[model samples]
Each structure stands twice: as C-alpha cells, then as structure tokens.
Target: MRILLTLILLSGLAAARANGYDSLPAPAPAVQSVPAVQKMKITDLQDLIARSDHPLIINFWATFCAPCNKEIPYFQTTVDRYAGSGVELVLVSLDLPDYFPARIAAFAQSHAYTARLVWLNETDADYFCPKVDARWTGGIPCSLFINNKTHYRRFFDRQLTEPQVDLEIKEMLKPAP
Candidate 1:
C-alpha cells in the first residue's frame, strides 16, 4: 500500500514539474512606453507619495530655469547609481503647458534624461505649493524625498548636490519607529 501511494504521489509531482509548477513565478513586464512628460494632477502626486515599498525622490524643475537645468546631470547620475535599488527618481517639469514640443520634450531628449519625467499640470502655485509642502514657496529646483515604509519625508527648496542626496537616502532607509 505504501509503495503504491508513493508511486502515485511521485507521478503527480512529475506532472506538476512538467506543467511549470516548480518554477518561480515570472516577473511583471517592464514599463517601457511611458510618455516623456505625462500631465500629473495633485491626486496623482498624492498616490505616488503614498507608495510604501520604495523610496521616491521628486525634483521639481522647469526647462527655462537655469539652476534646475544645471542640476539635471547630477540627478541623472543618482538615477544610474541607484537603479534596481528600489529608489525611484522623478523629474517633475513645471514648464508652461504649451512648451511640450518646442521646449520640454526637446530638452529632455537632448539631455537623454532617462528617469521618469512628469509635468505637474496645475498652474496655481499658491494652491498646489501647500499641497506639496507647507514650507514650499513655489520654487524651482526643489527636491522632495519620501519613504512611506519608514514614514520619512523631506523637502528641499534649493538645488541639491550628489552628497546631499546620498545623505537623504541614508535617512530614508532608516527603520520605521
């Protein structure tokens, strides 16, 4: 009886292996077709901020802002170094709505900015600024760090350096209380 039962179980195991039940599940497909700059609403931003599995670094900038332009390369370097580390970088463009083809897209393509790029569609800085951060004065070159898992958040209203971002990442990685 034992031998008969063992043979039946072994055959079932072999059938399951043949049907791929022994292998790890496949990974989700990569998102390779995002728009260069999707129009993002405040609600969209809130949802992004609430993601708990990974840390997010959001840089607010515009095409015409000189300081914002200068900091792009540094942020790009951060993106490359932190790839696959559960750290997401988003360059939020505050460019005027009409500048997508003539300025925004051209500038992003020219710089080869590979990080996710989004355009905050709201124009009323006074109303939206407080939504982002109470201390924000609607400044370009601002960077916000959020780690929902740890409940850590930070806001920087000026341009950021590589060192500053490194420090911020360390803070974001600290364990939640």
Candidate 2:
C-alpha cells in the first residue's frame, strides 16, 4: 500500500510540474506589460491585414516548434532595426489554448521578445490556412508581409533566415507598381 501511494503521488507531482509553463524561464522586468494574448479568428486576422497602414509581417509560430523558436531572435532583430519606421512585426503564436495569456507571456518575457504577440485562436487548419496563404501547409514559422495601401503582399511558408526577413521588409516598403 505504501509503494502504491508513493507511485501515485509521484505521478501527480510530475503532472503538476508539466502543466505547460514550468519549462519556461522565469519572466524578467524587460517586458513592461504582460499583455493579454488576443484570441484571433480568421476574420480578425483578415481585418488586421486589410487595415494595416504600414508594412506588416504576421509570423505564425508555436512555442513547441524548434524552428519557430530559432527564427524569433532573427525576426526580433529585424523588428528592432525597423523601429519607428512603421514596419510592424506581429508574432502570432499557434500554441494550444491551454498555454495562452500566461505561459506564452512568460516565455516571451523570458526571451525578451519585443514584437507584438497574439494567439491565433483557430482550430481547423483547412479554414485558416488558405486565408493566410494558398500554399500554406499549416506549417509554422511562416510569415505574410502586407501593405494595404500599396497593395503589396508576399508570403513565405517556410523557415526564413535573417537576411530574408530583412529583404522581405524592404520589399514590403517599396512602392508597388
């Protein structure tokens, strides 16, 4: 009976420790505000794209994706470089709903990520995928660049390097023909 109770207790403790937020480092003071992770549907994203006045990059990523984690610093660097230029970089997280508003905020704060963070509260990939990109296979670390005023648009549904991100930003800023 003692051994069975010990095993059960250990399992419970393990589960409590693994509730999606324990692995992330503790938050730092760098992030002034732990903003609410806005839950966005496909329609909300469409409105964001349509109403953006300046160049915007909506980067779809998830906390569990290794490649997505790797690309964030590169994207953040470019975002900082374009500061005050109205070149916006929004990091749209595809993390499950369970991790929202707190765990995700802690992860971003720990990493000191300055880009705007939002949670894409979407479920069906078939519905939202084509709205972002026709070729999107629902793979993350993808980015969509858009400037509504210029009618400029571009999409990359793969891992992007820093130079590619920089160049993409520059491309978005160009006057459309």
Q: Which ten residues in a row have the lowest lDDT in candidate 1?
A: 1-10
lDDT of each: 0.72, 0.78
Clashing pairs in 1: none
RMSD of each: 22.9, 8.9
- In angstroms, how far off is 69's CA in candidate 2? 1.4
Q: What tens-digit string does per-residue lDDT give for candidate 1 at 1-177?
A: 223323433454466467764443333235433236777987798788885478888998776566777888877787667776688888888765766534565567656677788888776676677788888876667999998888889999898888887777778777887
* Model 1 TM-score on a 0 to 1 scale: 0.76
| Per-model TM-score on C-alpha atoms | 0.76, 0.82
Q: For candidate 2, which ten residues in a row score worst on lDDT? A: 1-10
